[model samples]
Target: MRKAVSVLLAILLAVTGCAGPAERQDLAHVSYLTSFNTFGRDAYVYVAQEKGFFASRGIDVEITPGTGSVDVLKLVAAGRADFGVADFTATAITLAKERLPVTTIAAIHQKSLAAIVTLEGSGISKPADMVGRKIGDQPGSTNQVMFPVYAKAAGIDAGKVEFVPSAPPALPQLLAAGQVDGIGQFVVGTPLIEAAAKGRKAVVLPYGDLVPDLYGNALVVSKEFQGKAPDKVRSFTDALLEGLEYAITHPDEVGPILKKYQPTQDATVASAEVALMAPYVRPSGYSGRVGGMTEERVEKIIRTLVEARAIPDGVVLRPGDLATFG
Candidate 1:
């Protein structure tokens, strides 16, 4: 009788495709850092959380707001955060300059959105106009870090332009108050900045217009995490990108979703930011797979940085050294 019962239990287990309770209950917990506050630009992580995308991949993600891309990169390198979303150019420069143990697992935006934004009557309609003017921004933000390169490309003397340090939330207000001539911001930030300006038109000088080859934000992970759990890294990246695709496609829905996580964020402004960001996420005529990148393009970016004096010429880097492709 006992042997018959044992055989029956074994048969039932096989039929049900059961695994050990421990194996079934185990889930990887990770902390994810966004490049900035809970703006629409960083809403996809919330989308992933709300849609159960991370949970479906056996991950429990704690999404935290980062101060800036450069700060996010530093935190990820220090292993304070398991993963981070940051600008590709900032990460590349840091990797070449400091050899931080970080790698980009996926590309978010195909083009750089960095820009110098100014209000009407600021007399800063063009890059050259920025010379001898004050530009306010977070000290280490992508826009501030890359300003010199943008200035050089636009035939402006970078040294003459003064960069005023301020918190991210204060920048738009600073510009509106006429405390600064311009602010370093991304192109998608137009709606929010314009709203702050209270009827003033924003004159945006986009960095991508002059430096076309540069890529934007990306998913970065520390080498330690990548080595310890490569499969988890891939799973997390897949889930995050899935959320990004959905967020960009459903901007209206994403606005409410971001508002749910960040009550301070205005849903309408969030929606507008996502709408403006859609074209950069999937550029026109780009047939490649989503989040996919190539070595040739990365190499070109490095060379561009070198030529622009963003990185030391003596420091050598390759795509494989900074990112994992395929």
Candidate 2:
């Protein structure tokens, strides 16, 4: 009887010892929130998840679609998500001024993709032509948020332009139906807009062309996460950059991967959007580095936000406070 009890104890000890290391090796759980629903612009995250980049770094990432950039920052700041991608120029800077404990870790878009789109024969050929024209706008969109800066830069009175608020999904349809003369949208959405136009060519006036050197979306992490798991933060950034580079180099491969993850997404449109975003992701004369931000570039973005009165004049932000590539 004593031998039987000893044998059982020995087996239990062996089983526990064998299971411990395996359990410890399980991937850490992490969540990433995107500024909007899964679109071609979110190729990096989709590719990273599909290609096992996050898993290779010992992270099991759960990607959630956001309603807008502000929502993404709010979610990350509240500790609801470990990381998020949002508009670094307007949304992140504004939130940072409000004393939210969030900082951008990497600049994903070296140039802004936000644009004012019009179809051919709309007679809205230029920014100034938008005056007195009803433009379709989605509340809280990056284009709408930064339109004031564009208007000021172009010497146009924003007050004269009637912005017809509509849901993002409804904007294109409304424009095609002649409800609005133009629409504020992203360059990546050009394909969708053209498709909606049903043979009418869409004209794009990219914000990057208007506001030179203005940065766009970025990967942001909560201050609490950065304080506690700095290594994880770094690891996540590195993996994401790898994914970005991969997507950039293999644009054709990205669409299928994205569609695999999101079956409802149009494959042709997704592919075209990826192609459109490549230049913004790695702009002309870029330093050939993924996820790099310069202090001057960041300051320019914050200054634009202030000049547009999007944030309070008293709000102060330094480059270090807004972002840290390391």
Candidate 3:
């Protein structure tokens, strides 16, 4: 869904974005892993920096840009990182099956962000219309599982949509070239819409558009850190929330912040990204809200994973065992 644009931005942006004044708690040093591009999860860290939330709490935070889902999870489980931002499926499956020593602290994107995108003129308005169309998706990805479940339920045969390996950036090209009829994208919709609005004509089909709820972004702290630096983890979460809350309300400020943090971003591109992320900001009491989680949502994902064989048969997950939203 996200690619590493500039890792240096990850550190500087969060460390200096807008951290606010809080009582000096403890001078703690922590390394965290994240892969949600410069503007997604990375932006949350930047918001913390901008708000001065981290410093007020006396925490020295270092942010590292991770490559993909596997790399991010491995960084946390291997103890190379005290904490990480990752997906619920990868975290839960690893814990249930591989028994890795990592636990999620929060679910950032309460709603699934993955989507099947198409051009506006493609006349493919519904998921079922994707049948018999060439749909691009990263091979052997979490989305591969997600797409099939969605397509099947939509009455679109999974085998009917030709699956291909392609990332979000590649989708526009493949789509414009008419090489593929649609793409299952992970990043939010504005990028595709803007890409189309600017002439690409992409149509984004968010999973929530039809598919059942599937978890997206999340923050995870290692077992070592959980036992030793619970305060640190909690402080990080609080600082992160500071940023997230700002991003949710004052999205206009993000462009300049992106310019300062991720200077490489073009205004047009960043503007599109800003719009793309808007929908992800759930209502105060809905979706992945501040300190939000539901057993029903988790079970929906767990059952989906188990049904897909991502976890072993007969596996059941407990709330307190896998997540801690509060």
| TM-score of each predicted structure versus truth | 0.91, 0.88, 0.76
Ranking by lDDT: 1, 2, 3
Tens-digit lDDT track of model 1 for 4-119: 99999999988677555555467788999988777888899999889989889998888899888889989999999999988898888878878888899888999998999998
**lDDT (0-100) at residue 153 of candidate 1?**
92
Q: Could you tell me the TM-score of candidate 1?
A: 0.91
The segments of candidate 1 whose C-alpha lies over 4 angstroms from its true place after superposition are 1-25
Per-residue CA lDDT of model 2 for 159-249, tens digit only, reads: 8988888877777788898899999888888888888889899989887787887887888898899999988998888899899888878
Query: Each candidate: what lDDT?
Result: 0.89, 0.82, 0.66
lDDT of 1 at 123: 83
lDDT of 3 by residue, 211-311 (tens): 44676767887777788878878888888767767775666676677667677645455545545565554633564456466777786777766665556
Better of 1 and 2 by TM-score: 1
**C-alpha RMSD in Å of predicted model 2 compared with the true structure:** 4.4
